[model samples]
Target chain A: MNVEFINPFLTSLLNVMSTMASMELEPGKPALKTDPIAKGDVSGLIGMVGPQTKGSLSITFERELILTTMQKMLGEEHEEIDDEVTDLVGEITNMVTGGAKNILSDKGYEFEMATPMVVTGKDHTISHKAKGKKIIMPFSSEFGTAFIEICFEH
Target chain B: MNVEFINPFLTSLLNVMSTMASMELEPGKPALKTDPIAKGDVSGLIGMVGPQTKGSLSITFERELILTTMQKMLGEEHEEIDDEVTDLVGEITNMVTGGAKNILSDKGYEFEMATPMVVTGKDHTISHKAKGKKIIMPFSSEFGTAFIEICFEH
Candidate 1:
């Protein structure tokens, strides 16, 4: 796992959250996660592949943060996990990944991204489609907490 | 969605079931699915990327069939959906997609496959990463029924 490949996601996550949701976030120390069980109640995951590398990007968001972020971004009040929450999560995943994709492309790691999927459940498991180090970047904000997972195989 | 690209998945699915799990599968009519909710209790999904094309492949299996298939393949009895069931489903997804990948690559559609993800839950939603028509091929046997979903973007 190259630190070069991971910085883009953390940077992009910060960019997306502050710019998109007007929430400033501080990134906690990134760590390797061996378990597939999700830490949040809702998640959005997408796959990435290029000629030189293949990987996956995902955001597992706690319910409170998701609801608050949704309120900030979409002006909707969501009480529970529903279609709108998942849909919004999917869009957030796309934007976050897209931001990273551009930064990576500028660095010569050109790849195409797949559609994002949103999974919602307590104790849900997300098996990433990439075989490599599963690194998680946990972020904290005034709203709540969220995690960004990136699996890069170079 | 061209039937040309879809046949490989169905063919690979039947072949994988027969050769890998010793279950004979009869593929039903392939149809378009707009809904994201999965029909079965568990599912495995993978994404595909190439210079010219991008898509995703997935398999959703009934609990009964998964347990039975595990019994036949691993000679272990599993009455519940746990780590073993999800792990086996991930392997099946890999083999099925690998078979399809070879067929597609031989036809000059060279691409790379991402690792497969196993998702377990009743009515869980699987978001395909590719933006295109989603075609689902249903297969039935004495064991039970499973679905192969292929989303191809050209």
Candidate 2:
């Protein structure tokens, strides 16, 4: 995958978190994902396809981190992973992906993004048959750690 | 969703099963799905997005049905759901979606499809926040029952 295709997602994620939740995040080293399971209790996935690329974006969040982030994001308290929490996860995924799409479209990569799909379970894995290089970007915020996984075939 | 947009999928699914697995199938009346859980142990999801439509297609098969379908499709006997089974599910999803995309494209609905995403577990649910009408088309075959869910926003 081209690093140029990944920069937008990183920028969008950091921008979304800081703007929406008022949480500053520091990104760790991006690495290849060897494991199958998404390293979180909940994940939001958005699929992307263009003339030259096909990929999917997954943002997995630890349970406590999402709960805390959502509470702060919504200006309310969420005691558990209710419908609101799930919706928040989906919205966050959409916003980040849509933000990336805007930048990518301007760069002449015309693509369409599917609606965000939220999957919740322990040890659940999302396997995409894109045969792309899978990169995992881990970010840390005050609430906790989360990961942005991008698998792109160019 | 417009029936024009959905007919291609139904036709492709029936055609894929018959041509790929040599299995004849009967589709039940499509019904709107209000529940969150995809009603199967394994599911193949393909997301679709275009100028006029944004949604997903999920084909959930009973474990036995998939195992048997794989056995018939590949001329092999499989007792359990291994990586091959998972791979077959993704391929089937891809083929069906690709077939449909071809027809839809000919009809002027040019869209890009994401690579198939396979979700496997005992009791797992895939929640999409598209707010579209989710219609599940159930089919009964000699092996068992499966469903093709199309959630499209036009």
Candidate 3:
């Protein structure tokens, strides 16, 4: 596994989130949360593949956190989160991937990205076909908490 | 605008296509010869947003090209392109964004990427919304041709 592939992306994401959104993410011991946050929850995901391995990365957040994040991003208060808010989250994933891509290019990795798809509703789980490894990096902010999961197989 | 944000991604995609398969891409030009090939058409897309801009990246290819590429990646020739082939294309986009993200991180741009959606069809057009700038880089291969379109407002 190319651990170098993951480090730059993780660092870039931390810098973007902290500096641009004024949000703080403390890296916790690797673990997946046990409790469900309820259904109709929206989460952002990005997937990656290279000459050696392939996998997906996802950032899951609670509904309230997403709403508040949007509020801050748009610079206005909101009483309710709608389709526009969903679109906002999808775009957020795009920016994170964009930031990570830049770092990966310097390391000599080349690939293309797909348009984002917004998943809604509850009772859904994301499954990866990779049989090699999966790493989950959990994080939290003043607005809310989220997790980044990286799964890949060579 | 940030042409840097878009150029490397296009280049990386060209590299992936050329390296993974025997497809020859004529950069900056559309396909000169149309070949009738049997394969599914798959498209993957991701969106991006920030304090300064918002946009999306879309990559589309013929089904045969996707299957041949995956066969080359895995070093096995598959009789058909199934879920695995689609997943491979999605992962390719994931890799592309991962590379792009690193570059944008240095520029102080923060972003997140959404889950990839695979749309299958014979012939279709994918569109995005951007009020400011739009760029399209088209490449051709023996199996087929695909293009990357970046549209955003800064």
Among the numbered candidates, top lDDT falls to 2
| Chain B global fold similarity (TM-score) for predicted model 3 against the true chain B | 0.79
User: Scoring model 2 with DockQ, what do you get?
Assistant: 0.63
| Model 1, span B1-154: residue lDDT tens | 6876789888988898888778898889888977765577788877777778877777999889999999988999998988788889988998988898899889877778777777777656665645688887788877778988878788
Taking the candidates one at a time, how many backbone clashes does each contain?
A: 2, 0, 41
Task: Count residue pairs with overlapping backbones in model 3.
Answer: 41
RMSD of each: 2.5, 2.5, 11.3
Runs in model 1 deviating more than 4 A are A79-82, A142-144
lDDT of 3 by residue, B1-154 (tens): 5667776677778766666665556776422112212122666665565555655666777766777787778766665545666677668776776567766777777555544544454553443434445566666667666766666656
Model 1, range A5-85, lDDT digits (tens) per residue?
A: 889889998999889888888899888877765567888877787778878877988889999988998899999988788
Candidate 3 per-residue lDDT over residues A1-154, each given as its tens digit: 4568666657766776666666667766554323222222565655554555455565666667777777666765655545576567667766776777788887787544444444433322333334546566666666656666665556
| TM-score of each prediction | 0.88, 0.88, 0.48
lDDT of each: 0.81, 0.82, 0.59
- Model 2, position A81: C-alpha lDDT score: 70
Evaluate fnat for each of the predicted models and list the values in order: 0.52, 0.66, 0.06
Q: How big a share of the true inter-chain contacts is recovered in candidate 3? A: 0.06
